[model samples]
Target: MRVHLGSDHAGLDLKNHLVSWLTEHGYEPVDHGPFVFDALDDYPVFCLRAARGVATDRAAGLDSLGVVVGGSGNGEQMAANKVEGIRCALVWSEATAKLAREHNDAQVVSVGGRMHTLAEMTHFVELFLAEPFSGDERHLRRIGMLGDYERTHELPALPESAVGLGPDA
Candidate 1:
């Protein structure tokens, strides 16, 4: 699998570690930014690029998933979710990681560097990557709704709209 990665100063070390680990584990890890950390560095730059890259990869039929990291991972998650076609989940545990993929069909995971050990992070990320999204009808429906919401803020047009089609009835 090919994975996209990025981080700020707070997550720099962990991101570097993940790059090697992903490669060693047979994943093509793409690093986004902050090769040399600067305290003032921002997470948006790298996070956005990484997220877009992964989204593009899947769009281009090259890859399927990605992992993003930062100090709290909140901003990174928010940024990643901004990408079209990316379902990004902020995962802090193995179970959540698995559920994010299995239930939410998350294509990308966000990890908080200050929240857990390297081993824990690795475990969560592995679980996320290993799990497959369950294609259960309800789950698929919900994902579709979310995609619809992302593209068009209006609620899905329904047969109910026909009820009021007659003007001034």
Candidate 2:
């Protein structure tokens, strides 16, 4: 599979490690930026670029997916998610990685290099790549709602009672 990789200085070492490992594992790893480590580099610059590439490929008439990383992965994941058509998941474990892809259809797995060992990170990547989205109707509908919100900034038309919030008195 083709995977885009991006990371700030905090996650640079892990990103580089994954790139070399991914190459050896028979998967195409595309680097988005920060070819050389730079302390001043920002996660949004590289993360958003990677997310855009993955999201645009399918939109701009190609097919691709990606991964982004940083110290806690929280900011990077949020940054990537800001890009249209990109679903980046902050995965810290094998189960979450699998669930992110299988249930959320997440195209990008965000990892925190400082959060785990190199072996754990590798396992997270393996789980993410191994799992496929279930494509169940409920999941699809929910994703659609989020997409709609992305475009309109309006509340989803679900029953407020079900979501536990009655009409705003």
Candidate 3:
């Protein structure tokens, strides 16, 4: 599988480490980087590129995923999520990593560079890459709804149960 990676100065070291590790583990890692870091660099620039790479590849039926990292990963995750057809999840634990893939069918994972040890973060990435989407009916339904909304700026219909619960209720 091909994994696309992007990061700002805060995540440079970890991103480099992951590239080597990912290659050694038999996965191809594409670095969409700030090959040379500037402390003032923005996360969105690189992260959006990485996210787009993954989204385009997946749409072509290729097996691909993405990772975006930053000081707290919040901005990186937000940037990635802006890409159409991309499900980017901010992962902080083994469970979150697994759930990101299994439940949300996330194709990209964002991690906080300052949050965990290198080994711990690597393990989270490993789990995320190893797990497969559940393909359950509910999961698929939710994903479909998101895709629909992305394509059509239309909000999903409210549930019948909530229809009567206005200020008057």
Candidate 4:
């Protein structure tokens, strides 16, 4: 699998570590980063590029994923998700990592550099990379709904109950 990584200064160290770790794990790691640490560097600048790389490669039928890191990972995930066809999940634990891939079929994961120790964060990434999408019919249906909504601005019709109307109304 090919993995694209990006981060601002706050996550430079973790991103670097992940590059080496990913390489060691037999995955191709592409660094789309601020090669030199600049405190003022923006997460979106790099994270978006990494997300785009994953989306493009996958669109071309290549197996690719993305990782975006930041102090809180919130902004990085937000930025990555802005790219159409990219489902970037903010992962804070092993379960979340697993769920992101298994349930959401996310192609990108964002981690918080300052939220956990190196070992913990590394484990999260490892779990994320190892898990595969469940591919259940229900999951596929939900994913299709999201993909369609992404491609078109139209919202899915809400059930009457969901819209707060009585069932018979």
Which residue segments of model 3 deviate by more than 4 Å? 167-169
- Expressed as tens digits, the lDDT of each residue in 23-113 for candidate 4 is 9999999999968889999999999999999999999999999999999999999999999999999999989999999999999999999
Each prediction's whole-model lDDT (CA): 0.89, 0.88, 0.95, 0.94
Q: Report the candidate with higher TM-score, 2 versus 4.
A: 4
Q: Candidate 2: minimum summed lDDT over ten consecutive residues — where?
A: 160-169
RMSD of each: 4.2, 1.8, 1.5, 2.2
Which should have the higher lDDT, number 2 or number 3?
Answer: 3
List clashing residue pairs in candidate 3. Answer: none
| Alpha-carbon TM-score of each model against the true structure | 0.90, 0.92, 0.96, 0.94
Query: Which residue runs does candidate 2 get wrong by more than 4 Å?
Result: 60-63, 160-169
Q: Which residue pairs in model 4 clash with each other? A: none
Off by over 4 Å in 4: 163-169
lDDT, ranked from best to worst: 3, 4, 1, 2
Ranking by TM-score: 3, 4, 2, 1
Model 2 Cα shift for residue 163 (angstroms): 9.0
lDDT of 2 by residue, 39-145 (tens): 99999999998898888776766556788889989999999999987889999988899999888999888999899998999889888987889999999998999
